[model samples]
Target: MIEIKDLHKSYTSGSSKLHVLKGINFNVGQGELVAIMGSSGSGKSTLLNILGILDEADTGSYNLDGVPIKNLNETIASRYRNKFLGFVYQSFNLIGYKSALDNVALPLYYQGIKHSERNDQAMSYLEKVGLASHAHHLPSELSGGQKQRVAIARALASHPKVLLADEPTGALDTKTSYEVMELIQGINDEGKTILIVTHEPDIAAMCKRNVVLKDGLIIDDVMINQQRASSYV
Candidate 1:
């Protein structure tokens, strides 16, 4: 449940503004699994940052699950971010000293959820991502795929409405990437809205819809027969 109209974002490049997203219009419906495909400098990362509430667009509108997203104070933005969005990144972003379970439970800690309740919830999410047994492991002990699964578990622990993954498979090998995509596909099948930002064609093909970006604009948008990631996994 995302909607954007004429969204523009730019950054200061010395004396000039480096426009990254120029008049971009985009939409993703509930339960839709969409891939944002782009080469370097395509502004996909910028758009993802805006969608995740990590950055603000320079102009135009963004509505998420019916609420306008713009100019939010840090408090409101943090609340909305916790309430509606869960993010997975290429780096996994796990704390070095935390166990997988602890990493997943960190978000609930911010919500002030009690230790016992949050731990139970985090365990359930880890189970969902097939990482329950590995909950005791640290990121250092896990393989790349295992680390990503832990990240996915952490993202899902909050029961977020939208799962935003940027280059989720970028750091993994091909087979591992497929496995992660398969896991994501299973999550999407259960009615979660998902948007993946990736430059990999195979990764994008696994999604139901693909939006190709070029030079800060969406140059192609198409719905394709979803190639089941399970097939590759």
Candidate 2:
């Protein structure tokens, strides 16, 4: 569902330029769960930004579900991002004051969905993530894993083509991390394409494929037997 070919990106800082992605090529198909792994300065995050249309590549091509992605204006980019991409960040990214239900419903609100319909959809997703009971809780009122589940529900409420998670379990304890990964695994089993950027090997092992980046280029890509997080959770 996603294809990126020979993507190159760089950032200018004074007289020197930092090359972040160089000659990178990657593809993800429908119903696939892929993990992107890299150490610091390995360019995985840069690749994520380009894939999300949060940043434009300096050269090369990105095709999202057969549509070319390059240098889209903010308006168009925002629309496409909303329509095609869902994001889960390590920080949770939920508004401190907004209740879980409202946060989950926020994306539909942007699309001008009616309030009642959006709330219904949001509640459905919260139930999907096993967070329906906490719908009225604010981010501060929930534990790290609960907050992450609410964040995941928010991402899913849009029903986007791909869910991009950056270090999704970074803030939780081992047990909680596995619990959250189990939730993610269940979602992928239902055919949602997922691309996760993470540094943890055990977490990456839970995915069906692993792609490693080093020095701004992909050093390895391999499909493996998926490990079920439920085994540990």
Candidate 3:
């Protein structure tokens, strides 16, 4: 459902240029769950930003569901992103004052959905992530795991075709991280395409395929055994 070819991204640093992505190429099929694993400066987040249309690449082509992102204008890109992509961040990006249900309903509100419909959809997504009981709670009232679950629900409430998660478990403890991973895995099992960027090997192992990046380049792409993959979810 997504294709990236000869992707390159660079930034001017003082008088020199720092390349962050170098001719990276990859294809993510519909309903496939994949992981992008890398170290501190591996450019995984940059790639995710580019994919989500939050940032533009310096060069190369990115096609999502047959539409070339490079060809889209800012307004068009924003619309496409809102309609097709869901993002989860390491920080859980929730509105601190909003109730969990309200936070999840925000995207739909922007999409012009009716209040009743938005609440219904948001509640359904929250339930899927096992956060239904916490719907009325504020982010401050919830645990780390509950916060992440609410974030996931917010992402899914958009009914996106692809879910791009960056360091999803970075801020949580092992138990909470595992719980979040299982929720994500369950989403993937229901046919949502998931691409996670993580530094944790155990997290990457949970994906069907793992791609390792180093110094802004893809170095390894491997598919794990089906049984091992099943264990990850």
Candidate 4:
């Protein structure tokens, strides 16, 4: 569902330019769960930003689900981003004062959905994420895993074509991380495409495909037998 070809990006600091992505090519199909692994300065974050439309490449092409993802104004970019992408970050990125349901409903609100309808849809997503009982809880009231589940629910509430997770389990303990991965695997099984940017090997093993980047280049890309997260949970 994603296409990238000869992607190159660079940042200028004073007289020197730091090349982040160099002649990179990658593609992801519908219903695939892929893990992107890289160390610091590996260009993984830059790639994710481009994929999420949070940043643009200096040169090359990116097409999301057949539509070109380049040279758009911020307004159009935001619209496409809301329409096609869902994000789950390491920080959870939930509004502190908002309840889980409201946080999930926030995107729908931006889509201009009616208040009643947005809340209904939000609750349904919450139920899907096994957080219905905690719907009224604020982020502060919930545990770390629960907060992440709410964030996932928020991401899915928009019915995004691809889910992009950055360090989804970075803050949680072993058991909680596995539990969250189990939920993610379940979502992938239901035919939603997902891309996870992570540094952990065990977490990468849970995905169907793994792509490794180093020095702004893809050094390894392979499909492997997927490990079910449920076994660990």
How far is each candidate from the true structure, as Cα RMSD in Å?
A: 0.8, 0.6, 1.7, 0.5
> How would you encode candidate 2's per-residue C-alpha lDDT over 154-230 as one tens digit per residue?
99999899999999999999999999999999999999999999999999999999999999999999999999999
TM-score of each: 0.98, 0.99, 0.95, 0.99
Candidate 3 lDDT trough over 10 residues, lowest sum: 224-233
After best superposition, candidate 4 residue 199: deviation in angstroms?
0.3
lDDT of 1: 0.94
Better of 1 and 3 by TM-score: 1
Ranking by lDDT: 4, 2, 1, 3
- The sequence of per-residue lDDT tens digits that candidate 1 reaches over residues 1-233 is 89999999999988998999999999999999999988889998899999999899999999999999999999999999999999999999999999999999999998899999999999999999888999899999999999999999889888899999999999999999999999999999999999999988899899999999899999999999999989877
Clashes of 2: 0
Which pairs clash inside model 2?
Answer: none
Which run of 10 residues does model 1 get worst, by summed lDDT?
Answer: 224-233
Clashing pairs in 4: none
lDDT of each: 0.94, 0.95, 0.89, 0.97
Query: Which candidate model has the greater lDDT, 2 or 4?
Result: 4
Q: In lDDT terms, which candidate is top?
A: 4
